[model samples]
Target: MKIIGIITSPRKEGNTAWIVNKILEGAKERGAETQVWYFGDLDIQPCRGCWGCHKGDRGCVIKDDMQKLNDAIDHANAIVFGSPIYMMQMSAQAKIFIDRMFARFSPRYSPYFKAENAAQKKLILAFNQGNPDSGLFQSYIDYTKHMFELLEFEVKEVPVVTGMRNGPAHEREDLRTLLKDIGSSLVGE
Candidate 1:
């Protein structure tokens, strides 16, 4: 199965990114082809309120890079989304990406979702916070989980890494272990 890993941290190499790469490593070990997107590198425009995308053959009249991203998501068998926690919410980059999925809400194009059978690709969410108190991030996490469920993704359990406030935090053995399990599960699915 093809698995797409989306890293939403602006840091070139931050705690969130480190965890995502580790997951990719684990996913690769499981023989799944992988594509990783450094979200910070992209010029992802926010979804406008235009109803054009819902208007017939023309989808997402904004006409930016979102279409290609959507196509990739449609093609993938599984998805792993990793984002840094900002004010107890996902980073702006990740939020915009999720909002752009408004194009998918309408059945303008087929194959992304089989509404009849309710069959969909598996999805996993991974998040990280610098603080050890992960409790604050729960509400945002649940919202993301709900978003995926509405999108027809059969969600795998969300695994988040917290207490990583700074670098060298990757040195922690627990981070390695948790990411390893979550990443491996992505593949075995």
Candidate 2:
């Protein structure tokens, strides 16, 4: 199996990336190939809501970093998305990446999946939040979950670590263990 990890935190080597790496490490240990993409390094522009993809276009009308990212996403067997929470939601960087999925939008996605018998990919979400309050992160988590479902992917896991406003949240033992378990579960081992 192959897994593609998309890092959405602007902070390089931040807590979110640490956790996502652990999960990827676990997947690799289980003998899967993996690739990582950092959104912070890309110059992705936000969606214009043009609906160009709805008309049979396979890519975004905007010439930006999203198209390249989308190509990688299309080739991967599984996907991992990680981000830092901002205002109780994913960071602006993460939102831009999500909005870029417009390239895959259309009623044809369903028909295409059926015609090709699309592989059921394991979708994983990792989030680091500044707020320790669970309620503060629920909306973002819920939205991420919904996005995965709508994309026709099976949710393998969504593990969130909070209270990182001060330091590395993934350093906490609880969070590390949670991420490890999520990775292990994905491998069915």
Candidate 3:
């Protein structure tokens, strides 16, 4: 199985990336083909409210890096999404990436909608927050979980790491072990 990791933090070598790498490490240890994407390094344009994909086109129409990203997602059996909490929501980069998935929503509203079955695909959400308490981001977390559910991903885990402004997440042994365990569970290791 191929597992893809996406980091949406704008900061180079940011905490969210560090955590995502750790998860990928565990997946690699289990012999799963893995790929990672730093969204900050990609030119993922915001959605243009165009219904091209919904109206008989195969995929998105904005014609940027998102198409490649979507292709990777289409082939992956599992996905790990890492994003830093910004103002109690996912970072702008992550939000834009999610918004670009508007094409997947059309079968419900349009007669021209072409539905793709992305169900049963495993998904893990990792969020890094400045607040010490994870409880503060419950609503935001809930929204994320619900959104992914709507998109047909089999939500496996939502791991939130709080109070991460001082250091990289790689140095946190507890988180490292937790993420590693999550990764192993992905391939039934």
Can you list the residue pairs that collide in candidate 3? none
Candidate 2, 52-156: lDDT as tens digits: 766664557888877677677767778888987777688889888767664665445452353121245668988877777667768759877877666677777
Q: Name model 2 segments beyond 4 Å from true.
A: 107-119
Top candidate when judged by TM-score against the true structure: 3
Candidate 3 overall Cα lDDT vs. reference?
0.84
Note the clash tally of each candidate: 0, 0, 0
lDDT of each: 0.76, 0.74, 0.84
Worst window of 10 by summed lDDT in candidate 1: 109-118
Cα lDDT tens digits for candidate 1, 1-189: 788888888985887778778877777888888888887777789878777767785877776677667777877888888888888788999889877777666443343555432247787788888788768778878978887787777888787777776545478887776776776787754
What is the descending TM-score order? 3, 1, 2
> Each candidate's root-mean-square deviation in Å?
3.5, 2.9, 2.8
Q: Give per-residue lDDT, candidate 3, residue 177.
A: 83
For model 3, the run of ten residues with the poorest summed lDDT: 106-115
Report the backbone clash tally of model 1. 0
Kindly indicate the candidate among 1 and 2 with the higher TM-score: 1
lDDT of 3 by residue, 1-189 (tens): 899999999876889888888888888888889999988789999888767877775777787998788889989999999999998899999989988878666446333443374556889998999778879989879988887876777888898998787666767778878888788788863
TM-score (C-alpha) between model 1 and the true structure = 0.88
Candidate 1, residue 73: how far the Cα is off, in Å: 1.0
Among these predictions, the greatest lDDT belongs to 3
